[model samples]
Target: MISPSTSQVIPRAADSASTIKFRDLDRFFLGLLVLWASRAWFYPGDVETQIGVEAPFLFYFTLACQLLGFYGLFRLGPPRIGSALMSQPLLLALIGWGAVSMAWSSAPYNTFGMVRATLLMMMGCVYFRERLSLSDIVQTFAVVTGLVMVGSLIAAVFFNFGRGTGFHVGSWRGLFSHKNGLGEVSAFATLFFASYILAARRAQLWAALFLSVSTVCLIFSGSANALVTVGSGLALMGLAFVTSKLTPSKITNGLIFIVLAAIAIATTFTLVTVVANSLGRDMTFTGRTRIWEIYLRFAAQQPWTGWGWTTASTNEVMTNLVRTTLKLPYLRSPHSAYVGLAVELGYTGAALYVAWLGKTTVSALLGVARRNDKISILRASIAVGMAVFGFFEVSAGVLPCLWLAFLICTEPKKQVGPGKNARA
Candidate 1:
């Protein structure tokens, strides 16, 4: 089993017990509130949006949390949480570009707001460093996921009950106003909780319940993409387990199993969702492929910087061509994150973006494979989930979810067998 780096020591405070707990509770509450009231959290028609307010209250609240976190960073001074997050060469450069990207973002103010939120979540992570167990983190996710499921269920019941829409299959939107948004949240939550469930040592039955409920929500979402991603991720993990069991020697076999599992899961979901439309799904994905082609064609117009941020908004010509040529509806932007980055940031930005992703992916996979510590399996699962979702959701690069991914990747690995990180 791997031990902590000679230089990587976790910081502790004289009276950190209650203080750290408070921070975790605050963070969890903020996240829950946002997820529960996401629609009204910062709506386009809300006061913040109507009065032409540049940044939303949620944005400022997050910024305040970051300020507090920075204070904690310096005040609670000691060995940093993990150098990989702040000192990674490629990732650091990418974050620098991301800061610049915010200036030219389609919604600059919104992007800035989200950045603050992301930082705040990271603060919560650093503050509660060794205070949390694998089970502790998992239960927190389960709680948040439970909230998400309840919200979705409420919205679904509302849409289907006493309405004249004739029981539409795809009209149920939970915290957000769109069914697709609900699908994204459910997919994220499912994978998030599922990783914890798999790594958990005790309470397997409760973990099973969480997975079952999350699965039902994902299916009822009727989001073909979400279903495909979640199903494929599980299948990939299952394969990894099977292969690990088959190996003659389990020592190096476990490491190989972790690496293959991460890659397989990542590749499966990315390919399935990215290609599902081309295989005829009769949905937004059906239009994504066409959108990608059109984005490339326009990007070729100016390969260097391409079109500046919001300046690259899809025009009617490309939208019409795709809809007519491919018989799909008009989608405003490339449905894929990579394509979106290419259209807005140009090749230079796209190259940097991809490099950043590659670096992070490598770091995550390495973090899983090299460490025989606790939560390695969970970290691997999270790395796979991030890669899978990156293909479809633009938020893969943003807060809440991104912060969750960071926790999974950077947390200390428990030196137990695979899928049993948390001892009973």
Candidate 2:
């Protein structure tokens, strides 16, 4: 017995509900894609042996997923792919340089694979930035990483799939191949959940729960580097929040941030020293300085253009050289992102990377000044944290999770006008 207007309104309401359901489904699928790209789950084994080698089934399955993801991203039609690419000119330059290095690479095939992976990962970041709101991206990551943490706990408790070996013996690695991997993921989860709690008015209970779990995981993973990284990041975030309240001027805020950043760096160094001493480690950072010395010597051999992208760890000859030099049978990475980049692409590539980080830091600070949102503050903090973490870990080159997070944080904020979808 409804009137004509009411009948029409009923259908419109139903249609809106249907659209919402479809959007939720779409996001669910995207979350799965994200989990895959992040490598949140991998077979338990020696991480060193797994790198640069993949099972046949996994290789093809991943290839299919990437192809399908690329197709879907384009088909869904992001608003401004060109603009997104343009905004990350330095990233593009870095990728271009990586591709060019294949020409000189002793293992051109390996370099090609590494460059392709980097390009695809970058494209995935662009899609995330252009198609989804920052909040949506953060929420997806939070949920995915939360699940990972929970699964790790279950695996460790039920299946005895937690302990590490060979120097990291007795540490909890959980679902990751190494304790450091778990630590990195846990640190990221903590950051994501903390940011979510600060930004959201509702559903913060879940974020708080996840944050607590992640903090526990971080502690159990026993990665001093991850602990330091997260601590520095949180400190910077706190500073940003404080500065945002104190001033409206971008210049003043920038000055304040610079001062705070310096203090944070000094404090972090002190913490590192204290942690090292308590852990019975020397100033050499458990022989990392010695490794750096050897890496620098190799890098000096090709100061302008190194062996090739990813060759620092992938090429058999380079691996043998490092193993023989370090007198260790197994070695996975240079252990320093900056040194790895310098070894792979030489000083020019390292300079470009530093320049990009500087640019992103400035942009993040400006965003905090302009928006004063938790997301902006988190972005600024993460930019600073990653810059510091790169000194001790291979956070830049091949680590999918860290690199993806970096891309998301560095993306420029979009402007919304009246009559447009604000979140979009």
Candidate 3:
């Protein structure tokens, strides 16, 4: 027999009330919005081609996400007061340059569509910056990734939703539309979880669990590129770790330099030859080299302005080659983000994009160096993961949902420690 006060009714009630706070709801809905609108295997059509039956619905659904996201902002309060955004102008410059390229886009109509989507997504990123804290962003992202893992397991058991065919054979696709897409996201999530674990080193059971699931998905995805991206990210982190530990002693410095040089050479050589041989692939990278060759040759003709937002400078050779040789019904990029950007927007455009990524990465690393917060360290790892992923994939330019997550999470925060009031 417990008395009313002794049972702690008031505290329990307070805790219950806290669970349903506006901010909590805000985080859940915003995370769900990112998932709904981002690149997942949930039956949405590509920005260029409306493939599935639900393509039209998904397109409009994403637009609604924009409106809802704005309303959510209004519900909270006015936008934050600061020039924090102005401090980071490279992202804006990148998107703005993308808009300007429409004038020279080979596919003008498609260019407008793609740019319009990018603008909407850019707004989402801004909303992320204005509203959520860094903790809110990473926790929400981790939660969503956890849901994806559970959903993939269920889908795989009941139907063929997550299984790969053709070259992938018995591999898993998880909830992604393609094996590479699944692998890419899974690998990125691995970096995310790893960063979380490394930063806090406490209550990391959830992050470790997510990391294992993501690694499994990455392996089952059979996306060689995804595997390579994960490896590259690890190598980059290793390099950062070693560099962080270096000393100023002359003998130690000389030894470290020699070791680093040897490692770099071995990594480069093995990445080119040993990796390909082990994977049963050739130097041409399963015809990707040919596809890139064609696109590069065409891009050279219009090096300054190239083509458009979602296409190479000229699709004539690219289209014909895919149709005749590859037998793929639709035209695709050269399977590398850098090459795709160079072909679509020329070297100048690609440089801006790469520069924006580099700036974000450096900012995060600087924050980590300052020990600003665990989230800052997490963002640094994520940026490294994205840099590696960018070499083999394209998301920032094509997919809105996942790219929105990356842009939002990786938005630089100066010094907002692990407290509740931290900045995102």
Output the number of the lDDT-best candidate: 2
lDDT of 3 by residue, 1-424 (tens): 1223211123334545654475577686667666764357555444235355556766676677656545634543434422433445665666676788888777778777766666555555556655555556567777887678656656555667677655556877767777776776777777767767766647677678888888887787777777776676666554544444466453454355446746874878677787777877765376576666666776797787767767752356565665466555454566667777887778877888788777766666544443335555566676767776676666634346464456554465444555322341
TM-score of each: 0.68, 0.84, 0.78
Tens digits of per-residue lDDT for model 1, 1-424: 1122311333334436876676466456444433432232232222212233354675666455456455545534546544423534444453445456665555566445545555545554544443343444545556666666766676566754311122333445555444555666667667656766554434667557666766767777666667666665555544554554555665565567666766875785577566765776523454466567777776787575655443333335654665576654423446666666576667776787567566554444444344423355555555555555656655554335533534432555444575444221
Model 3: residues >4 Å from true position, as ranges? 1-21, 42-51, 68-85, 242-266, 269-285, 313-318, 325-331, 366-373, 396-404, 414-424
Name every residue pair that clashes in candidate 2: none
- Identify the runs in model 2 with alpha carbons over 4 angstroms from their true place: 1-22, 41-44, 47-57, 76-80, 201-203, 248-250, 266-284, 396-399, 402-406, 414-423
- lDDT (tens digit, per residue) of candidate 2 on 103-217: 9998899889878766766666665555554555666766877888887766655665676766777777877777877887777777766756665535667778888888888
Q: How far is 43's C-alpha from truth in model 3 (Å)?
A: 5.1
Models, CA RMSD each: 7.0, 6.0, 7.0
